[model samples]
Target chain A: MNVVLLDPSEVRADGGASLDGRRAEHVAKVLGKAPGDALAVGVRGGKLGSAQVVSSTKQALELEACVFEREPAPKRPITLVLALPRPPVFRRLLQHVTALGIERIVLLHTRRVEKSYWMSPSLEPAAIDTQLQLGLEQAVDTVAPDIERARGFKAFAEDRLPELAAGARVLVAHPGPFGPCPVDVPGPVVLLVGPEGGFIPYEIERLTEAGAQGVSLGPRILRVETATLALLGRLGG
Target chain B: MNVVLLDPSEVRADGGASLDGRRAEHVAKVLGKAPGDALAVGVRGGKLGSAQVVSSTKQALELEACVFEREPAPKRPITLVLALPRPPVFRRLLQHVTALGIERIVLLHTRRVEKSYWMSPSLEPAAIDTQLQLGLEQAVDTVAPDIERARGFKAFAEDRLPELAAGARVLVAHPGPFGPCPVDVPGPVVLLVGPEGGFIPYEIERLTEAGAQGVSLGPRILRVETATLALLGRLGG
Candidate 1:
């Protein structure tokens, strides 16, 4: 773990706080923390602090944490408008985007998206949260990306695209004949990535008309998850 | 497996050819091939063929094969020069590049590359070959990418690059002040990507002087593997 993240509710009534269960196990085994070891800790939506381990056991550990400074927000402002992918890929994509500290994510539906993907057990809120948490941990950041779901491309383009694109640089990833995607564009960007088969011509037209510029990643086709991570990495860099 | 790839020896063999061990297990269990099932197969340097399963068992299987036609070479010619990554990531990157039908891969050494990484057990030739085979199978291509090791950057850039870039477009991926990476660039390309911390300024300068154009995937810093795949996807597309 890059940084240890704690939930606000985890703090005990006393000044001393105990980390139990998986977190405790991670600390004891993976981190190999002993009594009096200083651990980097952050409270969700709160400030970061150095926690002094007071006692340790196989199942739980206690720490004395002092409130410190708040973690900084992400450097770049990024919002992803992605068509939902298969469950396994979605899980990896979520963690990767989170690690890169993206500001927001909008999971939209497209014609090519399989209906069964939406109903996957992996899409559960708790599971999604876990993936985001992993991303935050990887980047040593405290902010969690805001994730929203959209049911249809038409509705999202007609209703939500205007609002989302009002002040952001919008780019849509399609496999057609478009110029190279620009690197290091200034200001916030709203990136749209289609499902496996890619955005249909009509969908591309609608997004383009709604202020999204069609961009190409290159010639060879990439899997949905690979494309998402590549776009995020390229755009975020 | 998207395609079945066989070594040159396997192809030149006469009747009663046996596929033992893992290949046998995959054919019998995973692919559910029984006696007389027709399977698409390709010999490493020979021809694509349709093979009929003669006998099947968990541990071994035999096939009667007939040569058909050679699998065509990949359309876009691209070579990847990457600073080796961590073991797991390196394995995945190999498969990914293979899936995209890259022609060559040169694993180079860079300052940021951990010395311990070179000693990784995963770097064994057998292990590397397995990963490459997996990629070849996924792309349904018969040609195997030539995998080579470059000891150092200066030597490779000064001695080897001239011949490597004889008539190819050479692009170096850097997250600096470069414009978007070009898509649909015709002709052969030698894409260079740095390790985790990226190539040092001097390295970038040297590469640029050596006829490599600096290209950016955008502002976001991507992991080495991600950057490689992204560039391949965009360039190949």
Candidate 2:
């Protein structure tokens, strides 16, 4: 982890904090940090800062008051609408998009998305928090992305997507004879990416009717996580 | 796997072939192909085609002569120059770049690159081929990316990079003050990316002196794989 993240609740009014479990283990084993060593630290949904190790032990790592450095990195103006992938793929994409500083995520359901994927335990709140936290840590950012689920394509397209994407340019990442994906878009965007085999024609049509323009990233299909990062990267102005 | 890839040697003079082991297991268990089923197939570094399963058994899966359908997808006009990442990261990057149709790769040794990464089994020719094959299958493309290793940054920057990147725009992905990465360049490019903590100031200076213009993907620090895909996606025309 690039930055040590502590939940707001963990920080005492005196600014002292104690960390155990994974964070402690990572600080001790991976970082080989000792007491008095200053490390980059950030509060959950707070500011970036530095924390000096007060004490280190097998059970926990203690830190003194944080010296706030600066505000979190600016958030990307992108709302990712992705068809739910297999659990393993979902885990990686969550961390990647989060690290890229995405503003929001909508796990969508489409015809090509396997029904079994939604049953995965990775969709649980705890599991998602763990992944997004990893992303925030990787980027040294303090803001956590907001995630929502859209269980049905038609319902999401007709009811929720249009409103959620009302002021944003909505684009779907599709293959075949579509216009190329936009580059370095400076404004807010709602980008819809499909599952493994891609959204069926009917799903694409519905998304198109919902004000999303179908765009291609070229002929070679990329995995979900790769595509998400690529799209985000392309739109990063 | 999107397409079953066969080494050129696997195709007999008459174009018929038999496959066993991993590919057979995949066709049998994952794809559930039976005798007389036609499946998409491609020749390594060659063409895309279809193979009809003539026979199926526990030991081997036999196929009739392939009817070549088309040439492989056009290669991406880009070559990646990256610092050697950890082995696990290397594996994913190999597959990702291959799926994105990178024309070539040069894994360089830089100040931040851990020397231990050179000894990884993932760097072995066979192991690298396996990952690249997976990428080719995933993208339904037949060209396998050519990979090279540059043991020292200086040697690579002076002795080889100038020549290899001749006639191509060479841009290095760095985090600090630099111009934004280019998008949709309709020409060949040699993109350089750094290892984990990123290239030190001296290393970046050397790369800058070597015809590489340092470019930023903005403020959010992306992992090596994410940065690589984003750069590639941004440059995809």
Candidate 3:
């Protein structure tokens, strides 16, 4: 873990904190910290600070806080409009986007998406939060990106695209052609990636009509999960 | 697996072949192939053919080959110059690039690369072959990308860059003020990506002076593995 994350509730009135569960286990087992050892800590939605180990036990560890440093800015201002993938793929995407520090995520539906995928247990709020948390831990950051779900493509394009596209670069990844996805895009961007089979031709046309630019990754097709990361990496790299 | 891959020696004069060990296990356990079942098979450095199961045993399976079909041309002609990553990450990258249908991979040295990485067991020819086969199987292609290692940066750049850059688009990935990686590159490309911490400023300068266009993926930094996929996806997509 790059940084130890603490929830607001974990903070004591006198600038101290205690960790339990996974965090405690990580400190004891992975990091092998003992009393008096120093650990990097960050408060959720807050700043980063150094924590001095005041007490240690197998189940929990108490720490005294030092000063807080300004947190790094979150990743570029981008909104990812993704087609829901299989549960395993979704879980990995969540962690990846979180680690990359995306600002927002909109999980949407497309023609080829299986209806059953929406019912996956992995879509539970707690499950999503857990994966996002893992991403934050990996990046040593504490900020959480806002995530929303769109039930229909038309509704999202008609109802949300106008406002979302305002003053933002809109790029949609698809197979056919419009030219390659640009490398160093400036300003805010909205990246739309389709399902496994990809967005239908009609859907691509509609998105393009709605001001989204059609962009290709290259010649060979990629799995939805891999494509998402590839888009982010290229656009954000 | 999308396509079954066979070694050059696997093809018999009578067009009959048998698979043992891992291939046999995969056919029996994963694919659940039975006698008389048809399977897509590709011979290394040859053509794709249809194979019909002739007999099956616990330890081996025999097949009868039919006609061969010419394999499709590579999606794009891109040669990847990568810094060696960890074993697990390296394995994943090898498979990923193969799935993307890349034809060549050159693993090079950079300042941040750990010397110990050269000793990884995953670097063995057989092990590397296994990973490449996984990629070939996924893409259902018969040709395997060539993988080479470059131990000295300055020496290789001086001795190889001139000829390697001939008649090909060359781009180096780095963070900073470069424009986004261009999409729909017109010709063949030789793309370069640095190790985890990234190539030092001097290294990037050297590459740029040697005729590489410096480019950025985006604002957020990505892990080396993620960056590789992203670079391929954008360049190939």
In terms of TM-score, how similar is model 1 to the real structure? Answer: 0.67
- How many pairs of residues collide in model 2? 0
Worst 10 residues of 3 chain A by lDDT: A66-75
lDDT per residue, candidate 2, B109-221, as tens digits? 99889898999999999999999999999999999888999997889988898887788999999998888999988898999999989999988888888889989987877
Off by over 4 Å in 1: A12-15, A73-75, B1-88, B99-144, B149-237
lDDT of 1 by residue, B1-237 (tens): 645666666654563366788788888787898888888777875566677888888898787865557654554577889988989889888887876677888999988888898999889999998887776665566666888899788999998887799899999999878876776567899999898778998888888889999988654445566567657656743
Tens-digit lDDT track of model 1 for A25-101: 88888789998899877777666677888877769988885454765454458889999999987987887777666
Docking class of 1: incorrect
Index of the highest-TM-score prediction: 2
On DockQ, the stronger of 2 and 3 is: 2
* Leading candidate by DockQ: 2
Best by lDDT: 2
The whole-model lDDT of each prediction reads 0.78, 0.89, 0.81
Candidate 1 chain B weakest ten by summed lDDT: B8-17
Candidate 3's C-alpha runs over 4 A off are A32-37, A55-58, B1-71, B74-88, B103-130, B137-141, B148-222, B231-237
Model 2 in CAPRI terms: which quality? medium
